[model samples]
Target: MSQLGTLEDLPIGFRQGLTATNLVPLWPNLRGALPHGIPTRRTRPLLWRYSEIRPQLMEAGRLTPIEKAERRVLVLANPGLGLENMQATPSIYIGMQLILPGETAPNHKHSPSAVRFVVEGAGGFTVVEGERCPMEPGDLILTPSGLWHEHGHTGSEPVVWMDALDLPLVFALEASYCTEGEPQNIRNEPDASQTRYRRSGLVPWSGWMRPPTNYPLVRFPWRDVKAALADLASVTPRGEAVRLAYVNPETGRECLPILGFSAVQLRPGESLALPRHSASAVMNIVDGAGVAEIDGVQLQFEQFDTIAVPTHARVRIENSSSTKPAHLFVVDDAPMQRKLGFYEILANEALPPI
Candidate 1:
């Protein structure tokens, strides 16, 4: 390939004239726009330890009341992407939110889809479109786009949950905004997680006759997911990764449009290398300790610690314990990449489907 001309190589007079007309040449910038191999990425492989964040999060609860700070949170920003951007990856935004006892986060809805993974404490609940879903450690609750959701704590202690959203993507498109409203009048019936979609491959009889709802199940109990992972691990081969994707029970598609979520389990003393993918991802260690090597950067993670992986990066995770399995909750932008027709996975050899 021929070397491209630099912008500075152009005559100053011509460059100034082009700038005055609000136009610039593309020849000098082609390589930067479309790199030879990998696409440019601003995300970095970094881990946030819960041990370090918990104290500051608790201090935030003490310093700010619910009224003053609606949904108090500390964003897990990637320094490579600029801290002011408030992004964990290019398309994903993650934060640790806190709610003290007797406090309530006001009802509001935004354009970006979001999910809450309960981290610590109990008796916390989120009301999504009038269905109150209780929050427990490891539970995954969906607050999809345009859904009115509010959080409250009834327990004696504080509750914290990890908030993952497609805010960066939506905001980049200039379509991100939230509307505050009055508290929802929670319905008397139980959430769909308990009634309509109770188990895998089983839905309400009525669902068979009608069209599938966009989000039939909003809350996935961690207890159920953990059990499912355990059952999957029993049959999974030693070299394969035990993973399960979260999907809409009725349609069996990803639960959200922009982001995808999954639960992964690493067998005791197992070190598994993941296929490199075009999408970026964030993994929150749900249980046990592990070491994750993202594009050659090794990060030590424990329960509740969060790690970020950039696009098209190599990743390997190892269970540090010899007697216990390690579980992780992962959030990724693969769905968005697939929608845009660029999702790809590179594997050296044939492997079991995840």
Candidate 2:
């Protein structure tokens, strides 16, 4: 019995004199008092929100400049990060890294498709398969699944970015593989002509240049996507008609063959339903404000907010305001679905619990 229980057996007037905090309500007031008496607020705990965790992320977001200098691979959240927590997800794993310039994070490669978004950086470059591309804020780079890649900093200051990969997905499929990558120039940043330079712009498909490889030649900048949406303001972003599907520039399809990726624009207070109905998708709110509802459970999303929409979960994405548009990055195996003749069916109605 709690101290309150001992208190309950005291004179009735004795309990009345105590403040609500002094007493705990054990059962619903709907029911009469129990043999154990009322439960106290002391026994009930409060809920903590993610916003409450921001300070932790900020404080925990520290990484050494790079001691290995040439053979460096410093991960931001180390012994305290609890990376094993990601295994529970089993489908997607996301890791954030804060890399500084003048420090090369040793050249290494694994059998996984990795995507890097410049969370905070300037004039950084990533050499993938011998191709070096200029990196800037909001630029996207890919170290294709099972390909050799290395990183080198060119600017004066530090560069921090988010590293997202299909590690969990691969692990779930039991296709996980890793190894020390072959070193081409562990200490060298070769010329661009000798390697592939991702155009980050549209390429006119010339049937003669050779069939398109799974990887494409376009990098959509955050600013450009916003501008494109501004030009298309007349259209509503709700139905599939308003949704934009990203495709390979050469093939004009998703970024990669099996790994599909697209970007969408949402005006504040505006919303768009999940267009590719049955395919699973992971969306990162690049910019603007919004709420993502899956079967009536609403999730408020802002810039850099990521949400995973599992296969066949009826969902609707909405913006909370109107001044700014919500730009989002969507990744799914849409093309692969089509190739497998498994284009998902659109869930016309989002079902909510009674």
Winning model by TM-score: 1
By summed lDDT, the worst window of 10 consecutive residues in model 1 runs over 345-354
Residue 147 of model 2 has an lDDT of 67
Least accurate stretch of 10 residues (summed lDDT) in model 2?
A: 39-48
Give one digit per residue, the lDDT tens place, for model 2 in 19-55. 4449744433423444332212111111112243334
Per-model TM values vs. the true structure? 0.97, 0.67
Off by over 4 Å in 2: 1-90, 154-158, 182-207, 216-218, 234-242, 339-341, 350-354
lDDT of 2 at 322: 64
Name model 1 segments beyond 4 Å from true: 348-354
The lDDT of each candidate is 0.93, 0.55
- Candidate 1 lDDT score at position 96: 100
